[model samples]
Target: MGMTTDPFSLLGLEPTAALDPAVVRQVFQERAAAVHPDHGADAADRAERTALFASLNEAQRCLSSTPQRLRVLLQVRYPELAASHAGAVMDGAFMELFGAVGAALEKAKAVQSRRAGVVSALARAMLMADETMAADAVMGALGAVNDAMGALERALPALDETMRSGEACGPQLKAAAARAGFLEKWQAQLRAAHAGAVG
Candidate 1:
């Protein structure tokens, strides 16, 4: 409850900031199928299974976007991030990181539209950048992720609007999930890099 230390790991996934909906859904189905109450009719581990199921779901929702995922991570590591949202602005370093993440997300989206495997590539870029990026650069990348996350957050409405307009929602949702995976990977890399260097 107190930030759920290592929330990503709670679901048996790696410590990452963003998550691939496909993978998340896949894993959830696999795990949930095994642990769901219906499957646990004769088990004493029902409570634990339920907890795991819930954790998996929480992980999916929190890691669904860069911003939401970042917020959860920051809540665990930098509690102050939540505080600064009221009137005060994020630190300059954070602002820069947010911008970089947003731009990367846009690129990732384009790559997704073309059916390119952009998640690994985008993640590789972030991972490679991690080796030498300054704190400011790291924060900038995070900021960009936040921007991408903003785009993701707006998707629910977009999906609704698209449906109301008679456009297909399938392609757009797929693309958004793809880009979201990239953002998630980038955030994980950022956290990993930061922890490696400074933690």
Candidate 2:
């Protein structure tokens, strides 16, 4: 399939910002099984099945997350709007979470640096309390990120309703997608920091 192929169409779903992840998974599983290369009757058939299977997997990946799904929905339905808002600045709410995550990551890096400088076992042992505190801070930041993500997911259904009503929700959808992108990035960073602190 081409890059322009609509993932929702590939998965036999309507193009919408709100989709239940479980439903997407179930549909992908069923569709993938039917086109699986292993069941192909000949080499040419198998090759075709392989390509289709890959497209199905790509569709599943796109629809599996709220942010990605919203992006795809915008690209497919309102390409102009998506392009226009591509460089829009993040709103105040996301910036606050960004600050918290940044601080936690910095603390974790400091703890890791201190741990690295210690040569003696006793010195390393002495740094355990500091490492624990850093880990705790990382975990707290991760919780805040997750909470923000959850709130975004919860708002999707209403966003979908607005779109269905023929209202202009392009800006709202773009902002939500941008915020989700930030939260997703922060979650990864925080997890890595937590691992460094506690590993």
Candidate 3:
């Protein structure tokens, strides 16, 4: 509606980290339909519509996740603070867990890759036990990652509360963002490992 970079404004949403997914979806659908190129008047209008559509998609993506939404808000509301916050580090324990999960994923991948090259049934059978073990290890890693994510999610409300109250400085948000990134990456690796084991 307005030529602004504020994602919430672009998405026709109230500027808050706590967003309802349903509302975001509904608004995006309505706006996207309204700006569909088929409904544009001319080439110029179509170009503008295309840009708006892209912006709307980006806005929806940014608002759909807690950490991403927080990051966007920080960039918009406190650019200087956010710049400094970039150097913030995640907890040492979280980093340790992430490292362990990554190592497990690599081990699983190595087993899966080795199994892929085995042509003979006997050779494949010989590797089945190792494959099974690797899969089990991946599951164990996934469980640990999930546990860590659960703890982080549980603490998110407190962080949100502090941010809302202006009590949380930049580092707090930065740390949460960093942890979220690590958790997201770990979960993705776990998914890939699980899929490899399954298929």
Q: Residues 6-96, candidate 2: write the lDDT tens digits.
A: 8998999998887898999999999999999999999999999999999999999889977788888888878899778356477787788
Give the runs in model 2 whose Cα sits over 4 Å from its true position: none
Cα lDDT of model 1 by residue, 1-199, tens digit: 3335455565566533345667766766676777676555556677767766777677666665544554554454345544453433344754565567555445443333333333577764654433334444555666667676676765556554655575644434444444555567778876654444332
TM-score of 1: 0.38
Ranking of all predicted structures according to lDDT, beginning with the best and ending with the worst: 2, 3, 1
- TM values, all candidates: 0.38, 0.94, 0.84
For TM-score, the strongest prediction is 2
lDDT (10s digit) by residue, model 3, range 1-199: 1436878877777666556778988998898999987778999999988988988888877777766776776676567877773465666887788777977888788888897799999998888887788888888888888888778767766766777787745667666666766777788889899778756
What's the true lDDT of residue 2 in model 1? 34
How many steric clashes does model 3 contain? 0
